[model samples]
Target: MRINSLPLRVRLTLLMAMILSIACFSLMAALIYTARIVYVAPQLVPKVSTSEEMGREPLPVTIPSVPPIPSAPPIPSVPPVLIEQQINFASTGFLCVILIIASGSVLTYRVAGGALKPVTDLSKEIEEIDENNLYRQVQVPPSKDEVSRLSISFNRMIRKLEKSFTAHKHFTANAAHELKTPIAAMLARIEVVQLGGPPSLEEYKEALQDTQCNAERLNILVHDLLRMNADLNVAACVTFSAKELFQSILSELAAEVQSKDIDIEVHLEDIPVYGERNLLHRAFSNILHNAIKYNKPNGSIQITGTRHPDTTRITIADTGIGIPEDQTDKIFEPFYCVDKSRSRELGGNGLGLSITKAVIDKHSGSIQVQSAMGMGTTFEVQLPNASTVY
Candidate 1:
């Protein structure tokens, strides 16, 4: 049988059994060898006397003593009693060695199984967990041991799973509602036209314009959602200076900046950042767009950049409608809006910052906001310098 296919406990038990059995058998064999070396009698040869020193008389005498009478079965090479003793010793030694090997294997098997019992229980617990019962926590081992630590970790992981699952469910519902709202309006407008004999030329044009606007809003929302949820692992193929990257985004929003008559000041330092151009563009675009979108007309905006030891920092300070302290943390979550009515009125889908944060995180950077209501806001973004990235 292939050991690979065996259960962990069985494999462990067998491994321990094999190791103990080998050791026991080796020890028994060594004892037997030592007994033979130290306890067995050694044979000694008879010594011969020198003939020159004995110089004896040549008188012949024939004396056939008792030896001629019986050559009897040459007395057993080893005494019968000794042979019996040796046989008993050998038999007893073999029996003891066999018993020791058997008992040692059994004991090791049991000990190994006991040591792995906690792991086995953990496995069983994990196996029973599934989507339907993600809230069911694994039973933590009572002892403050490795097993308990593992159980605790598993519990934390499932808790996160539950939270994510809950969030996903919430997102799904909100997304459906958000999508449905615009479509329903557009459909209602068209149905009115259809029932009213297509209306006058001007009325038809008005309806088409409204429909087109809603369609565009829907398009932007769908695009933003796709981007926020995309597996967009962009490679750092090009390195761009921080100033130019920010300028490019600002240029894209120039029309809005013009419309708001917002004053922009640039104090950019020439610091190189390593990142995917498109991703950084999108991220900076969002930040600046937010700055532009929420700012009071003719508000002041400042863009600044600096070089730090490990990172390049870009700060965007805007005299826009500041976010409340409590809502700042939630701003980056998908579909979260501090002012739901205002967000809807402004056509904000609350996905831009979510996508921006994801992009920053992907580049191992960070973005943070400091703001107080009615006082304006500042956004700080830090990304690794070209030399330090990777």
Candidate 2:
């Protein structure tokens, strides 16, 4: 295969292996040459005497010339040229082995790289996906392998992300639509009060009250939206008694309860929870206020808390017009109103439940609602005991 087609990892591996093989081959050749020069040559050469002796040899001294000893069979006649040839052959063999290893390594790396390229591409493609773009899809080759499984999983994840993004977009659009009408009306009312002729004291008071009420509602709605975004960094580890917090919230809402002729019952168990006291109070107040606001005249609202071995459960049941089954799940959504007209009359921006839900979630607790149309509703909250470290 072409070098450029090989993946980086495989190419690097092959390159390293080739370098190592060449190094080993060079080392072996040097060792062989050194052995021949230092050890073999010394043994093969005939040694001469260094001690002083008679300067000239006697020529043809034939009397009593014993046959000269054969001098250890002439050191077995190993030709210098033949030894050089053997060394060359051995070096060539070593070179051939190195070449074979290098070639094999390169070929293996190329094959491995070709096999894994799809997986590497898939990883990079998946990494590029983010919240803003959930529609990009990976193309898997037609093969029954792990890559195919990965492709299937990636597709599923994309689908889920797409659904979540679509839902968020719809929620944002709906919230905008819901808030715009009230805001516009409030602005128009203010414009009329200003541009028109000066009004009587009572009329001025009423206009001011209307403007103030709308502004407050708008503020509450904005707060709820912020809370629903789940971007708050509120620390929530302060120790506070749940009972005392609930009592304070009830005291604050006394006037509202009295005005609506709703009887409030509080059952507080002595339970200390770790949370932000003000946030917890706000959550409870929202639930209690909603119950009173939506209840029938002279209805009863019951608040109760119980501490178990590992959890604290709080229940708020109101004799109010209950939520519809289909709409129950969405009641905690920001800007969601069960009865839009009635909500306006009640001076609500339809954000109380949303804020309440957010606060509860921040405490790592769960809130559940059980309601039937015209049969009133009950909200159950369970907070895990913080005394025990999990």
Q: Which candidate's TM-score is highest?
A: 1
Task: State which candidate has the highest lDDT.
Answer: 1
lDDT of 2 by residue, 1-390 (tens): 898797577677777787778777787778777767876677678767543455666466465557766566465577888689777868686877678777777776777778788888898888998766669988876998999888988888878988787778877887787678668878888788889788778878887888787777677777667766664344555767877887788788889888888987878767666666767777888898899889998999888888888778889999999999999998887768999999978877777888899988977889999999888999998877766424
lDDT of each: 0.83, 0.80
Question: What does candidate 1's lDDT look like per residue over 70-125, in tens digits?
Answer: 55453225557756766787788778877876787778778878988999889998
Candidate 2's displacement at residue 325, Å, is 4.4
Model 1's number of clashes is 0
Off by over 4 Å in 2: 1-93, 120-134, 139-175, 190-202, 225-236, 255-267, 295-311, 318-321, 324-328, 370-376, 384-390
Cα-based TM-score, every candidate: 0.82, 0.66
Q: Every model's Cα RMSD, please?
A: 7.2, 9.1
Candidate 1 regions exceeding 4 Å error are 41-87, 229-236, 258-261, 296-299
Please count the clashing residue pairs in each candidate, in the order shown.
Answer: 0, 0
